[model samples]
Target: MQQRKQQLLRRHRQRKRVALLLGLPLLFSSALWFWWLPLPLLLAAWVLHEAYFADHLFYAPGDDYDYRFAGAGVSVSITADGRLGLAQLEGIAEADTLLLEVTIKADWRGCWVDPRVLIDVAQPHDQQTFERGCAGRRVVNLSGLGPALAAGQVRLRGRYCRLAGQATLHVLRNPDYACQRMLILAPHADDAELAAFAQYQRGAEVTIATLTVGELEAEPYQQLGLSAIEAARLKARLRSWDSRHAASWGGVPAERCFQLGYFCMQLPAMRAEPLLGHPSKVAQTGDIRPLRKGNALPLPGDVDGQPSWFNLLGDLRGLIEHYQPQVIVTPHPQLDPHADHQATTAALYEALAVSHHQPQTLLYYANHLHDNDRWPMGEQGEGVALPPALEPLTVAGVWSPSLSGAAQIDKSMALGLMHDLQTPLPGKKKLRRVLQHYLAGRRWPRWGVDEFYRKAIRRHELFFVQPWPIKDQAQRPE
Candidate 1:
């Protein structure tokens, strides 16, 4: 409340400053000739001064926060700290990475100063800074945070701040991203998990990859009126968020995961098809990918100027050749809804066919295809049912390992770690509604969130396999 009062004072001063700037020029003219001009000028100043009262920022905070930094102009939280510090977090000390969850309110109509997370690392006396784009928020993990935690180098010291925004912090608990020699691919950041995380365990090598950078070149952010710099920063931040997702969820070493860096929302052009309506606007612009301070660009051979379809195919082929994964899991090309998802499946299929190591198995998953279904997710035919197009694929066997209750918690943590991507934008109203019901299931102990996750933890994760053709489902982990 005190801080808000201060911000109000500052805003008042700022408005007054602007009012003075506008009025002084006219008043000076009036002093010289148009004395009556001051009357209208003062009225304009008053109108502007009173306008600030209507600014609207609102958000929900968790139990961890004791204060409400509620305001208009885009910030609402139940758990916000005045001094900016970590919330009540425990059991995450064992995690290689941790996610700090928060909620935010953005103006949705103007440029917002991207929120920043600063972490003070131990012994090395180093500082890592991350920009958290203005959405109902999520924490930015510090560079080397996972290794630092695993190595017992230091306890993290953190703070959050954003210009033209307000944030409330929450917690995404411990995630054990364990795997050995497992390679998973998703067109988007979270898809890898939703698509393939049904059967993961620790103590194995794991490599996770995303086909696109997951920034629709900030089309949504721009629609929300962010500046170019702000948009780019958000893209880079999202990349970082996915990087953390790999480390924390895949339980693989950070270097093992990779992003293919395709321009988002524009894959149709690569498939010899028209661009999606959303990304079509940026199809011609070569600068859609985020170019951040530490982020890298695609190699010349992998992605051409506009990142064509052939380029995506080449990259997927190269990745398969390099990883030589025995079991390749990806989306069912014929069933997914998003253009990029379909493209990824197609590219992966082509890459595998063309690659030297044909791998032991090809498991095709279909989750996004059923989003609009009335039954919701987490079933073989109802929530997570396969499209008839993929009926022949998983006919051999589905390798869904029974997730122990404890394992379920770990999966939840992994899913929670992905809160950044899960945090919805105005455009994701439908998704939010789904999640709301999903979360409600957790509360009701009915066919809900628990049931949804139970699908992944089921006795088998459904997949289509052919004996020699698909190589007889890759040896399932015991």
Candidate 2:
């Protein structure tokens, strides 16, 4: 019995020895595999999530987001929800670039996340670079980044566990005013006025295009202010009017006649055909497509199938691309004028939202006179004399012609004629006449013109500029 007990003990010892020798490696391998599962799976999951929710996952620091092109700098901030929060850009390259380093850490195993560098320029051109690193040390050669500079701004975004973040850097270049060009978008067919203005300023070369949409041939003239008898008479006189004024004036030819009514009698005339006769060249003339309402020009599409609102953005983009103008001028949003005018201005604002290459300046034009009650008759039987003029009349509100020179006024009026082309109502005629009178007061005080009208409403235009390179919030000036 003792011998049997010894044998059993030896067997037990042998089994224990075997377990001690092999158990550690097995446990170690299993543990290693278990820990590793999360790395690959988590990476895959993260990638997939990012594919769909990258914008949502990345959070911007403040309301302002910034970028740079050449020497110019811009600041723009987007919300976590991807809405544009704050934007300030300048055409001059006066700021520096920002460099950001991203690091990751966990236990002994060290790894470096790719660092993305963004730089905003004064012009549309910008640059970016990406590098991989961890802690304060670099690991990989990051050589594949390819020629660092690009034609547009850089967009950087990423997420990491509970610590994901992103920032933009701006690179400034020297200012080059000679490179500037201006683009004027008008709804009417009077390109001559704008062209003359452009020539007078020695500004960039200008191109004019016309668009014609619907017609008002069947519509009565009285609907446009003529009495029923007047409408009939006007209709009878339509043939003569067409032969006399319907002919094209600007370099661009006139569009087809959709309808022949008084409403269609405005400048550039509302025709069913493309007024410029060159639909293809509309963009070259700096005239965006899908013309807004009230103008003689109509955008391409069926009103029922393709609404003006829907196609406005695309048209604006096309215009920007075609003209490549440094500055864009359109009507103001506040005028609360005609439906088509309002709609066009609204669309222009919307287009500015997505435009990366912002225009340098935006000018707003006042609407024509509407009611005598709103604009009572003054001395001279016209609205108050615009600034730069000595007469006081009543038709529309007074405008300070002093701020804008006669040159500017002439250009503005010319552009207005090009855009409207319609005969001014009594109120509009009175206002125009007043404006004309002011033209005689060539040496008006600058302050007088400057003090014309308080921008009753905020006039906002959107454009992309170089991002300012500001590191610390405290260092930024108000």
| Among all candidates shown, the one with the greatest TM-score | 1
Model 2: residue 176 alpha-carbon error in angstroms: 14
- lDDT of model 2 at position 417: 35
Name model 2 segments beyond 4 Å from true.
Answer: 1-180, 188-202, 207-305, 369-478
Q: In lDDT terms, which candidate is top?
A: 1
User: Candidate 2, 178: how far from true, in Å?
Assistant: 12
Question: Looking at candidate 2, what is the lDDT of residue 15?
Answer: 66
Query: What RMSD does each model have against the real structure?
Result: 19.8, 28.5
Model-by-model lDDT, in order?
Answer: 0.45, 0.30
Error of 1 at 108 (Å): 45
lDDT of 2 by residue, 1-23 (tens): 12333454566567656855665
Model 1, position 378: C-alpha lDDT score? 23
Runs in model 1 deviating more than 4 A are 1-180, 198-200, 217-225, 228-233, 243-245, 273-306, 370-394, 424-460, 466-478
